[model samples]
Target: MVLDSLGKSLRGVLQKIARGSTVDEALLAEVVRDIQRALLQADVNVQLSLDLTKRVRTRATTEKPPAGASLRDFLIRIIYEEIRGILGKERPFDLKPKRILLAGLFGQGKTTTAGKLARYFQKKGVRVGLVAADVHRPAAVDQLEQLALKVGCEFYSNRAERRAEVIVQEALAHFPAHLAVIVDTAGRSGIDPDLIAELKRVRAVLQPDETLLVLDAAMGQTAGRSAQAFHEAVGLTGVILTKMDGSAKGGGALSAVSASGAPILFLGTGEHIDEFERFEPTRFVSRLLGMGDIQTLLERFDELSDKESAEKAAQNLMSGRFTLRDMRSQLASLGEMGPMSKLMSLFPGIGAAKVDQKTLDATQQRLRRFRSIMDSMTGEELDNPHVIKADRVHRIARGSGQKPQEVRGLLKHYESTKKAAHGLVSNRRLRRQLEKQFGNAEAPAD
Candidate 1:
């Protein structure tokens, strides 16, 4: 859900395309105008936004759908490609032994992004070391130290020495055995002489393999100037855009940074340590267009859950034996994945369906209450939900601090879900229909 406002607007445009009867000039013109407006309102560069819409229009008019592909799908594909083209392609990271330096201006979430980067590398099974080289800022050392502890990575800082270069030089020697070292360097209000001089000295001492500028997505079009300034300062290898989830103007930063030739390496999607994700242009655009990103969804599941537990859940679901405990487990897994709206955005055609935020929030709250109610249930009741009578329901509600009617609602929901799951598993014709609907029955045409 990065750039929520822009995403909603774009999704609305795509929904119009989906609901249209034909792809005529009028429809095409309306679609292009809507897209251009969405991009411009998101603070995208004016010329870039106009050029993108022009390309989309040109391609839509000239291109033909592949065999068995609908004109709607072809148009959707064209928009996806043009928007993705501005974001730039992802470069595969060479994750060997190397040092990385983080640089940015003051108040851009540079320190927090350093922690997120540490966690990202830690998940990749790299032994990371975090250095607190931001000597000018008060408590910056303590902040990075706490982050290193939270991520369970090595930490080093010379609180006694104020020189950033001296601190990083000592940090390199401190982390000799570690494969990946990430240095959290200093920042200033702007690209001043002193800041550049300090970063240059630190760079000379560290000579990091990757020098990334931590930028705020809310900076909008100004992000390009900032990126160019930093890139010239110490030769930034890439950029890390932070606060993407909270910013409505992220599209401006994204397209502008790409124009500056500093590819975005990662995105800080949310405020949590686990919310960071590597930037993939096609997958990102696919999500934006409501095409779904099943790969990322599957990867998130794998990262958050146990492999054996996932396999067991799949088996139970397919065998029509899904239990209340299994449902609770799956719900918990979804909670860990992120907000209900964000999760919904990953499903094919769901984004354009315009799932209401109020409804998603209500559903999320109800799930939490259901989980709480389930926690008060006995193992016997979880395995066999039918055993719980009125008396037991009252007792369970009292135990969980929920109303009796709420308890009954949970049971009702459980029964309905279980029944539908059984239908999907046992009804062969229904399964075949679903297979076709989900595009699993045949190979898709290019």
Candidate 2:
């Protein structure tokens, strides 16, 4: 859902290609123009946008598709490749035992990103230690210390020391056993000599393995200049673009930073510590083009729920044994998946761009209301909805502080879901197929 508007525009352009009778020069030109408009609207660098479309145009016109491929598919591939070219190729971020230093200007979410990085590495099975090297900010040390405690990582700071270099030196010795030590450095309002000198001193003491610039996605064209300046001041190995979920100009920042010769190692999708993600150009463009990133979706599920519980939930739904409790658990899992818009973007042909924001908002609200209503239900009513008579419904409505009609709506939904699940359970062939899939057995033949 990052750059949701741009995704809608791009998907609209692709829809044009799909609906066209034939792929020709005129049609290709129109598609290219639409792409340019979308990029420009998303605040992409003008020259970069032009160059990308040029490449798209050249490839679509000159290149021939393979024998089995359709012209439309080939053209789409060209556009995907060109767009990805501007974003750079994917490279693996090293996760070995090393120290990472975060640097950037003020108000780029550096401290928050430090927490995210700590969570990231901790999840990767690395013993992480957070170093508070930002001595200038009044609460920077406290902030990093709290983040360290929240992330369950070792924390190190010398509050009395004014020089950041000294703190880095002490932290390095304090957490030597930690596989990944993340040093949160100070930032200035703008790139200045004092800031650069301070970074140099910290780097001298830290001698980090990776120096990452915590760039803000809203920086747009200025993101490139900032990255270049930082790289000039102190060599930058990679960049982490923060606030990606909320930035309409995220495309601009991503393209600009990639153009500046710094590989984007990660993305801060949201404010939560777990919302950070590694940046992969192919998967990102795939999702942007409404092709869904199945790999990431699977990873998300794996991270949130174990296989046993997931299989049990799936089996319950398939067997028409779903209860209000099961429904509530499923709803909670859905909420854990982040915003509905971002979650929808993970599905092919159903990206957030295809659905209006108002509709999504309404759906989310309904889900919350349903959950609240269910919370007011007793265990007996939750396990067996048939016992929930009109009187029980009124009681639940009053308990949940919702209207009687809303309680009836939840009941209606439950009945609809129960009916649908029964239909699936009654289908012998489909049930067999599902069992085969879930049991890891050989596929059931037609």
Candidate 1 lDDT at 347 equals 53
Candidate 2 residue 369 Cα shift, in angstroms, is: 44
Which regions of candidate 1 deviate over 4 angstroms? Answer: 293-446
Report the lDDT of model 2 for residue 171: 78
TM-score of each: 0.66, 0.66
Q: Residues 249-286, candidate 2: write the lDDT tens digits.
A: 99899898998898898999998889898898766776
lDDT of 2: 0.82
Residue by residue across 319-437, what tens digits does model 1's lDDT show?
87888888887777778778888888765446557689899889989998999999999999988887999999999999999999999999999878777765544443432332343
TM-score quality measure for candidate 2: 0.66
lDDT of every predicted structure (CA atoms): 0.81, 0.82
The residue-level lDDT of candidate 1 at 189 comes to 83
Candidate 2 deviant stretches above 4 angstroms: 293-446
